[model samples]
Target: MVTDFIELGFAMESGREIPQFSRFEGPVQVITRGPVPAQALADLDRLLARLRGEAGIEINRAAPAATLVNASFNASDVPQNLIAVEFLPRRQMQAVVPNAACFVVPNVSNWSDFVANRRSSAIDWTRVVSRTQAAVFVPSDTTPQEIRDCLHEEIGQALGPLNDLFRLADSVFNDDNFQTTLTGFDMLLLRVWYAPELRSGMSKAEVQARLPTLFNRLNPSGRRPSNVDPGPTPRVWQQAVEQALASDGGLVERRAGATRALSLARAQGWRDNRLALSLMLNARLAPRDQGEAALDALLAAAELYRRAPGGEVHAAHIDMHLAVQALATGQAEMVLDLTARALPAAERSENAAFIASLGFLRAEALSLIGRTNEAERLRVDSFPAARYGFGTEAAARARMDEIARIGTAAQRLARL
Candidate 1:
């Protein structure tokens, strides 16, 4: 654990610096998209204070003032010269920052996925203090334990050194993403960044030359940084797996949950086929409210799964979603093309319940394009498998019959 900190320090001592993550020139203000719990906001405030407080003392750096901006924004009511930290929902994200990556909010994050299937996003952008806008968001669904850790990491990035070091175990900079508080090593890095000698716009060479002096002053005691836990902390992978498996929410909620799980998995650089498939399904079957955005997610996930090796099952599921989106959006040619690819994949899949879903999707797509006879045959073939998925043979048959008449699969599991 301590080695993680030592390694991070050594890397910083290396002769270069990330240019975009240069420090903020002024105080930052925290704005909530909703009425965030008071305690959560307070906890975040305390974490930011780490730059100048207890964490600072460990590295011999002075603490800074703790202040939160408590107003909503508009041209008229905007706070002057303070960076805004907005906490909002994912769909509402484009409002605060139009860049696709800024779309992360509590409960949902369209934070511009790293890739559709991989789901890992480039979070570094959020921390960069752009000359025009120095801002970030606090997702409303952020876990309580994570409030401090996230603030330190994101705000730390805002201060400078905007890149994440996946190698660090002693700091929140790594993608393990489970650390909930600032570490001593992180404080040292902050010390190196804010050292008076290292000015805001110092070139790499200038910073590199001065780092050794800062390092020595900060680590005169020669204590190595260690994770709060002696062992590696829990990983985000398990959290993603659990969310993928959970069946607690309705269709829209479940899909959103899957998207988040996929995002979490992607955030940690974890790669798993099951999580990818869950994400694909959720995006493919998105509720009406999501419309084209849902289709965008489906297309991205499909492309991601398509490129991944040994993901034939996931590919088939993606195709099925593609066909679903096509038919819903009235793209007849795409429906025909996507279903033709999806049919045999369903048959080849060894999972009976999944095969039933694919079969139902295929039949629906076929009927949408003036192929009634073929649609009925496939629909009938799907019933036995669909019964298992739908929980009763009668309900499954009713669903198929409804699809045949209405040419859509709106109520397949509406009971949920």
Candidate 2:
């Protein structure tokens, strides 16, 4: 646990004077003055008070780290602050503050701990990737590599064949391996196979010809889909869509198809909050009709969830989705309305990411409404420094770009 804290401290101190300490510019530094006693609550308090007095700050006993570090640096008032105290016995520390923020003792020493603590919850790869990117900021990149490899191994074990196919496509697309990678047409074919409605138009030969044009336009490397005719089969189209959706490669037309799928799903009964949120995301590359449909579905979902029992957070999620969708669709009024409804729910839920997302969404909405100062403030407030896991970096960067666009748009409006 102590080692973990040291590692965390080092992570926090990256590119700073302190080797493995938080870069807290504060007046008081209450040294532990000796080994921590097994039962020294009174002594700890006295030290805390003295430190607070020296720092000219009110002694907030409620603030776990107020006395240890200056009041300004206390991240949370949780008792876990004691974990930062070096040379303290693990047992003694545990005894002193069983539920304190002092130190987090990881269950296991290595990857085995993850396996032991594994839960049945759906994995959010975005969060995992974000954490991995943050770890890159650390001096030692070994931990990030281990985490990435472990996550990949675990995901490979957990996901189904379809998901595996999608992941492989993502890898090829991201790596820009288009010549050998799956093509946009291949992904389209996969969609046709999985989703029956998309195959309404044209024959197999026409699709094959269209596939190359779409692939050439979408792939970052500008390589067309293989001309080797897979013959006229619905399977070909399904393969193409599946490949395109999974691939990291960018195909404008493929993106349009994904948007259409989201819109179609929204038209169906699958317009749940999660699905609506996904559709809103898809709106970034979707056609106007698809984007509008997604935005409407997200709004309806938010309203539905809001009225349902025990659905406040779910409703908030929907509202956040709606706000994001509104921004993507250039619906200023809708963004403001949805954000106004979602902010309270986000606060009630106390979800930091949700709150951050709300702030970002609000910033975008405010910008659209010509509120430049407020938009900028919200953007800065919403910027998250360290996300929990991997894949989150790309999402975070994208969100940041959205925030920047809002700011830029607001500036442009001001000029007008």
Which candidate number has the best TM-score? 1
TM-scores of the models, in the order given: 0.39, 0.33
How many collisions per candidate? 3, 46
Give the CA lDDT, 0 to 100, for residue 2 in model 1: 29
lDDT of 1 by residue, 1-416 (tens): 22333333323322233443254344444433344545566666565566666434221111222233343334444443344455555445545444332322211122222122123223333223332233555555443333334455555544444433432434455443323345566677776665566555544556566766667777777645544332322244334434544556466555655666666655645433434544565565567797677667666656655554324445666676566655555565676677667656445433445566656666766666668799789877777666544546676676566544434443233223
Q: Candidate 1 — which pairs collide?
A: 52-63, 106-140, 120-266
Candidate 2 off by > 4 Å: 1-285, 307-315, 324-334, 361-380, 383-401, 410-416
Candidate 1 residues lying further than 4 Å off, grouped into runs, are 1-17, 26-33, 55-81, 91-133, 146-149, 223-416
User: Residue 211 error for model 2, in Å?
Assistant: 54
lDDT of 2: 0.38
What is the clash count of model 1?
3
